[model samples]
Structures are given as structure tokens and as C-alpha cells.
Target: MRTEAIEAWTQLYAAVGLLAVICASCAALKTIVELRGGTVAFPHATWTQKFLWFPRLWLRFQLAYMSGFPCIMGIALLYAHYIGFAAFNPS
Candidate 1:
């Protein structure tokens, strides 16, 4: 019961971390396109335009690059470790 719950939670965390990594990749590609003077269309506007109009978007990008993906990956790793330990020492 508890082991099952832990396994489920670990899977959930891994899925979320994967999503974060994908998002980070997209953001990195957008940054590269913008740097090369190429355009990337977002929902409403181009990524370049968004960065210019919303300075916070730039900060968010930097934050994601610096910590967001790593933090999510860390959480996923922690959950996986817990699951492994629980499996080995069933108590």
C-alpha cells in the first residue's frame, strides 16, 4: 500500500520533471533563434517581441536555465531514491 503510493508519486514526479525539461529545451531553442535574428512565434507574438516587451520573461528564461529544470530533476531523483530504498527495505 505505502510502497504502491510511493511508486505512483515517483512516477508522477518523473513525468513532471520530463515536462519541465521539454519546456526548458523549447525556451533554449527560442533564445537561440532570437540570438540569431530569427523569429519564433508564440501564442500571441514572437518570442523576441515578448522578451522585449516583458522583461520578466527574460528573467524567467534565465531562472529556468539556471535552476528550474535542475530543481525539478532533483525532486524526481529524490522520489526515485525513496522508492528504491522502500523496495529494498520493506518496512
Candidate 2:
């Protein structure tokens, strides 16, 4: 019935939320590491440099994150709707 649809929708949305969180966290972590610069024995990365590097890396990360948000949201919303429809329509 309608209840089943709601349950399915909830599960779908929850999964999407989890995925978004993981993706954002990973990107953020990578950006952080890239911003931290120091070296003696290690190879020098162009991204890992003076104060300016942090802002640049951060800006890129933000842009990338923002770019992905819409797609992620759309996917999540679609999945939720599909699940909701499927759960309620046994036939």
C-alpha cells in the first residue's frame, strides 16, 4: 500500500544522503592534504605551495563539490521517487 511506498522512498533517500556525505568528505580531505605543503625528500607538487595554494585548492574543491551537488540531488530524488512508486504498486 501507500505505507510500503513511503518506506521504500525513505530508504532510497537515506542511501543517497549517505553517498553524498562520503563523496563530500573524501573531496574535502584530499583538498586538505593537497593544501598542506612541505618537503625535503618528497617530490614537490605544484599544488602544495605557499599561502596562495590553500585558497586555490579550496576554491577548486568547492567548485567541484558544487558542480556535483545538482547531479547527486537529482539522482537521489529520482531514486526516491522510483522506489516509492515501486513499493506501492505491487502490480
lDDT of each: 0.64, 0.67
Model 1 clashes, total count? 0
Minimal lDDT window, size 10, model 1: 35-44
Deviation from native of the Cα of residue 61 in model 1, angstroms: 2.1
Instruction: State model 1's lDDT.
Output: 0.64
lDDT leader: 2
Clashes of 2: 0
Steric clash pairs (candidate 1): none
TM-score of each model, paired residue for residue? 0.44, 0.51
Over 4 Å off, model 1 = 38-91
List runs of model 2 lying over 4 Å from the truth: 38-58, 66-85, 88-91
lDDT of 1 at 45: 79
Superposed Cα deviation of residue 10, candidate 2 (Å): 0.5
